[model samples]
Target: MNIAKNMEAIFVAAIVIASATSFATAAVSTPVIAVKAEASAMQTVTVTAKRLTAAEKAAL
Candidate 1:
């Protein structure tokens, strides 16, 4: 019974460590993801502007 309890404690500790590591990794990568999303948004805006300009020219 003592050994079983020890093994359970170890298992819980391992799970906590893994979860903490995952959170840390996500935190580290969040800024990178935000930057990528910002760049993508800028590109989309630029493309939309160009399309509008072309459409205006066509209308004229």
Candidate 2:
């Protein structure tokens, strides 16, 4: 019974450690990935102009 309790404690500890490490890895890697995604997802706008003709200006 004592050996079974020790085994259960060890198993729970191992699971907790594994979950902590997985979360730590994700926290470290998420920012770099988010920066790359934001850079790629960015967009730009362009503007252009043209001079109006005399007839069109007179009509207006």
Count of clashing residue pairs in every prediction:
0, 0
Worst 10 residues of 1 by lDDT: 43-52
Residue pairs in steric clash, candidate 1?
none
lDDT, candidate 2, at 58: 100
Candidate 2 residue lDDT tens string, 1-60: 687769989999999999999988988844554435577678988768888899989999
* Candidate 2 ranges with C-alpha deviation above 4 Å: 1-3, 30-60
Give the Å error, residue 57, model 1. Answer: 79
Per-prediction TM-score to the true structure, in the order listed = 0.41, 0.41
